[model samples]
Target chain A: MPGKTFEEQVRQELIGLRLEPSQQVWETLAVQLQQKHKRRRIFWLLMLMLCLLGASGWWWIQHNTDLAPGHAWTTHADNSTATKTTTTTTTPILPERIQPDTTPSTVISQTTTIPAHQNRDKNDYAGTADQLPVKLLNRQAPRTNASVNQSGRYTLPVGNHQKSALSKDLQREAVPENGVIKDQKSQPIPAQDNRIKQSVTAAPAFRDTVVISEDSKKSVVSAVLRLPPSDTTATEKNTRSADTAALPVPTHQPVDSTKASVTPATQSAGKSGWSWAVQVLGGLGGTRKSIGSLFAAPDPLRAYNPIGSGSPGSGAGSGGTATGAIPVVRDGASLGFEVAMEKKIGPKQRHLLGLSAGYHFYTTQLKVGARTAGTLLFNNFNVSNQTGYYFASRDSLNYTNYYHFLEAAVQYYIPFSFLKANMRWHTSLGINYLLTSNGLHYDYSGNAAYLFQNNSLFNRLQLNTGSGLDMQLGRKKPVWAGLQVDYMLGNLSKQALSDQHLFRISAILRIPLQKPARK
Target chain B: MQDEKKLVKDCLKQHPAAQKQLYELFAREMLGICYRYTKSMHDAEEVLQQGFIKVFQYLHQYRSDGELGAWIRRIMVNTAINYLKRRPQYQLDLSFEDAHLHPVDNHQPDLRVQMKDLLNLVRQLPAGYQTIFNLHAVEGYSHVEIAKMMGISEGTSRSQYARARGLLISWLENHGINDKKDYYAR
Candidate 1:
């Protein structure tokens, strides 16, 4: 026989070898796999949410762009003067209360020609003579009694003079009878005469000027005109005025008793009002047992040595040196829900400060006896100080500790730079007063001994700092979805053997309660 | 084959029953392979656990063209190699030159030798010899492949395997097993 047959025989025999593994292997594997599966599910779910967020934002942008076609309704209107020469159409910015109707019946297309003298100071006028006669079209206006010519044009009677003559021309064409302009349908257009009367008095120096308000500057013009409308009720007009009253009124313009409103062209400008949001978070919370900077917890069963002794591994804690005596404490699930009313403050309205009230519960599990007796320590006087609790058991059992807290916190948030503009980092600092359970309690089950709980040791006041990388979704009303990691600065227990501080990592979803105002 | 494809599809869907079924099907054979590479049963089981984890994690990448058992066996072999590299003791043993130790015994025993005896005889070789023997003689890897896997030269792999086989043959002879009948032809 060839010498290779030995190798061949060995290969054949060994390849068919089979050995059964212990059950512990599968049990551990199952736990790890479950965690992996959970992480994977969370990851995919977040990705799906992000994709939906992107899609919704895209749809919103598309929808708004379609609403006012071809008009350059710029957000940075202050710096928009340089590009004004190229813009063919410029309209007076409307307050957020006006939801422009797109019906063709209400569409008003007006071409206003800026006189040559007004275009001389480029810094003041922003547009060249070539950019004159800018066509103003309201594609979203509601169906009204505003008369249009055969070609769908609402011709503004041109004049050689300034603001007063333009107002007089408008008054001559659409004359008010008994303070109300009646449509062709003989329907009364309430407040139409008052708006024209107010515009005539409050109009600025330029006849056809597009005023851009800088971040630092209060507005100069507040001439928002509503022509004769058929369907608009008097109550609706009053409501619209009331909504505008909350906005910053330009000091330069005379306040019309009927309506005095100013439009802040950007989202940053509109963020001054209080916006409430509800935040829901869920994740893992654990106590970090450390002395000073080192994470070494003093071993409770340091004196016990169980090696070479008849000790059941499951019944009693494995006894060895100080390292082996360290107790196993598994972190439990943490969940919290809070409702907060916050306002954007500081420069550019980028920071947020708020007050929040919520409920949170944290749990931790330790393996101990089902029922044990041990020395108890309490803040109050105890006559029977000889190991007050029952002890002496070798049975291993899981004891879950629950700490429930009614949290009242003052939170402050600041922006942080991240990978993408859509994904923003928010750093939050909170000073919290949490009513907690009597901190960590001890029980001597078998070889395991010592505990950190005393009634006086529990500290209800805690301060925490947390940060999250949020994916800001939607433009009209944005929602923030992100992962937040929080660390408590103060220990939950006072005068404990180990310095026990809590830390948690959670997935947070924050939804704003109000829609942001837009121009 | 269709049942296997369905099992794989179900496993990919994260069905716990399907996962457990798949683990039960291959775990015994996989554990045996891990045992041959490690010093103790505990180490073998640890490697088996790690290997099974990788199997489930990258299960989506498995194509139905090859046999599922063969694919899983390949993963187990790779995992065993990694486990050996991770531990300092095994790392020391993996040094082929330093691990060339002489056999301690030359006792003559009964003429009959079982497969269990053969396995114990193979385990007596140093870690380098045992790994090379298992990879070449049993796992059917080429010397070049073994060198690449172990980060050694092809010549070292060949020498290790030869020494491993010689030691096993000498132990078999000492145990009074006839090479022609009990060792190879059986």
Candidate 2:
């Protein structure tokens, strides 16, 4: 009978060999694994924080909208309208959080008092004593009947039946350059005493009368109109009178010569809260060597057997011929795309804070010499192809390394005018967290060249800074298109062998999700 | 196969139980591989510990299309090679007489060589011969691959392997192991 060859016999015998290792090995491995998992937990925690920050920002926008003065009035009035009576009044005081710091100290006395019973009998008169307007009074006056309390807050007695007190602060805001009110067409209005009386009588939709006066004798009230929630298209006659009751006068600033400045400030306050914009960005990037080259081997290879040798060590022992110096190569290009939501942060709408989720693809190309015949090389596991093994037969082989990451980043943009008013320059800073990615590193150390997957090999988080120039496109609701350049500040990989950072140049387009904030 | 897939998935999630189970599944065979490369069981266990760490660290890279045990075995071989290369004591020097040898032609009627004894005999060879023989004859690597891994010419790898094989056969015959029963038998 024919027998197996010696090599085959040895392979067969050793293939089934098993020798159990000591228990200490597993214990050490477990400890190492625990430490690695701890780091992973921290990464996940950062991702969670980014999501929670975006969620909370969204919630704040909704909360502010619900509490707008107009919306709040519509809701509170609808609720309290049922308990309405002629004898009792309820004043809608602005929440302390929203109160302006420069509230005035003077109270306006009612100069033109109307017959309460006469208006009460009218069907159009929704005015109730329980729904009187907020009052401003002198801080120095006696606290007996109408003085502001010690903390400068005075709550009106709801059922007192006395007319609502007018704040001197409100009267000051109502008084402009000439101390008189005017219509939208720049036409001068009627005398102060009669206008206040006529405004109270003409505004039948008001459940409470709006009284604006500096004193009983000199009643100087200006007409600053805010359209009511109901009948937004009504004539200036009714809107100017009715909306005054809902306005919370800002405390500071000298009297403006023109009403244009005050009207827009009031309108924007009621209409705009947080303005969101959608940004679409795409860019090409490349990496620079940061710390060291990962491809350079730690030690030079020494050959056991020399070429044209009599014996293995005849001439190959100490003076072994060295392979040529390993060439230092730079990694290849990277491409990225992101869709983000930007929220205008300040009242002037000059600064924007944004949250983005994006895809970042990085590639590393190297010249791995020709693949030997009948040799197997490992590739990153591609979902499309079940097998990760491939043969490289060409003289020059490029390893198109891929890193697919789901990146979450927080970015802040500071906007300033550049060459013209229409062109804006925005400098931005961003903190990015690469939540998850495939870790594929090409290692040529083993018997065959294979792509090794190790998550700890790459840096997953980094800071980036950039600047962009945006040109306003449209006249009405402007669209902004810009060119942006971003530089990532650190190494791409955690390994000391690589010190490469990513830099990108991109085109960005921004469109407002809501109407642009009032200029 | 389904259980193995689940075990790999769980281990990727860093589940301690699944990790321990995966470790237990391959530890013995891997230690045996490590033992063949090192001088002592202690050194073998050290290589085993380091190799298993790499296995778990890179488990996610292991494509399920291939056998998991085979993937781990490759990593163990790499770790063992690195361990030997790093230490001064285990540094390989394969220089020896490149001479003609008589091929083993005698067929043993009855063979009774204990597996451990055979392993000892193989270990008794020089480190360079032992490594070249294991890489070529046991691991199924070609002379070209061994040459690339050890930075030697393909001709030298083939000659070294031939010398190792001849030495091992002579040692086997001289020990009265051929056609002998119950002599250090398993």
Question: Please, what is the whole-model Cα lDDT of each candidate in the order they appear?
Answer: 0.51, 0.49
Residue-level lDDT tens digits of model 1 in A45-103 = 85686567556544544433121111222111112211222122122333222332233
Q: Across residues A203-296, which tens digit of lDDT does each residue of candidate 2 receive?
A: 2122232234332223323222222223222222222333322222212122221221111112222223333455555555445443232223
Tens digits of per-residue lDDT, candidate 1, B32-80, equal 8988887777668778888998999999999999899999999999988
Give candidate 2 regions above 4 Å deviation. Answer: A1-11, A19-28, A65-183, A186-425, A428-465, A468-519, B1-25, B31-186
Tens-place lDDT digits, model 2, residues B49-105: 779878988998999989999999999988888877765554536443334443434
lDDT for A413 (candidate 2):
58
Off by over 4 Å in 1: A1-6, A22-427, A431-462, A466-486, A490-519, B1-21, B94-113, B124-129, B150-186
Q: What is the DockQ of candidate 1?
A: 0.33
Per-prediction TM-score, please? 0.49, 0.35
DockQ of each: 0.33, 0.28
